[model samples]
Target: MAEFRQAGGKIDITATKAIAYHEVVVIGNIIAVASHSAKIGEKTSAYTEGVYEIKKGNEEITQGAKVYLTTDGAITATAEGNTYAGIAWRNATANDVVADVKINA
Candidate 1:
């Protein structure tokens, strides 16, 4: 038998640490962004899909480049030892601090 669950775009998460709104969160290999600010141990919603502005590393990311999440929660073009985040929605130069990333597309 099969059952239906809620839509998969958003999920409820318990904050392991204080999380600011829009901050990137990594659960296992899944990467998401907090929907709102939440204190440690508080429950919050996170969007698993859609494009968001995420901080980037010092590397230039071309449009549609595969981006990964660093240990410190920034986006990078390097895939080694990092979690897959999303694709860059636009080109990001080395001096750019952030990039639009479309996740779970």
Candidate 2:
């Protein structure tokens, strides 16, 4: 028989950079939200599947729209050359700095 691990909703990650709690982090092609603060090279838990408030770029995002992470790390509706983060859980105007995103959904 195979040994079962913990649930998949959360997982341990080694910080590539100093990460603050609730911060959005990109690991390879996967995007996850930091559940707690951690310094670079330290291991910390992060949410792989959850809705979280993430910083957004200058674009209006509608609910259920696919959200992507720009090179600068902010979430946006654009997908060209950017990393797919998740779906927007709510609408966000261009002027809004934050959007509710379903991370890794």
Candidate 3:
């Protein structure tokens, strides 16, 4: 299990394997680009999702891309107009980097 403090609150994860409420700290290469609609107030707004980081190979990624990360380590990019309901990246860019994702419990 891993624990961290965020937004003046303590977050804890006790899963033997990575779960939905567990924060994921990933360091990999960008694999692809995705996009979706981001809601502003009560309306849907156009926005680029984010990049998918793979273990290897070069991928074209953009800011505001929408991707579905499977539990088996598979990333599927989607361009449909949908609001992501899980953890979202605050800063979306094309640069290959590490990301710390905090899942809401």
Candidate 4:
């Protein structure tokens, strides 16, 4: 089984006997801002993908802004100037995959 842990919550994945890796992606307008954490074991890999629409908050994040992830996890963000438009993740294990993202309001 796989596990996912975030700063605000956690989830125990029950679908591991069939999948060795999982990737999730989201793209749209971001109305809210949030942060999260993720961890991947050594047997599975997980990835998260999405696009963020900057509606508020500080627009200092550039397209190459550093997006931090948990151990063995990675985050990629694509933004136009200070407006972030997309986000992605790459998990290189089967530990805990968790992250926080913005939603379109």
C-alpha lDDT of residue 34 in model 2 = 88
TM-score of 2: 0.89
Which tens-of-lDDT digit does each residue in 1-105 have in candidate 1?
A: 979998899989999999999889998788998999999999999999999989888889999988999999899999999999989999999999998899855
Candidate 4's C-alpha runs over 4 A off are: 1-47, 67-105
Candidate 3 Cα misplacement greater than 4 A, ranges: 1-10, 18-59, 79-105
TM-score of each: 0.92, 0.89, 0.28, 0.18
TM-score of 3: 0.28
Model 2 worst lDDT window (10 residues): 22-31
Top candidate (lDDT): 1
Candidate 2 deviant stretches above 4 angstroms: 1-3
Write one digit per residue (lDDT tens) for candidate 4, span 2-71: 6855643222333323332233312222212223222342232223223433222322333333443222
TM-score of 4: 0.18
The prediction achieving the highest TM-score against the true structure is 1
How high a TM-score does candidate 1 get?
A: 0.92
What order do you get sorting by lDDT, best first? 1, 2, 4, 3
Model 2: per-residue lDDT, tens digit, 1-105? 978898799878998889999887888888888889999999998888988888888789999999998888799888999999999999999999999999877
Instruction: Please report how far candidate 4 places residue 76 from its true position, in Å.
Output: 14
- lDDT-best of 1 and 3: 1
lDDT of each: 0.91, 0.89, 0.29, 0.30
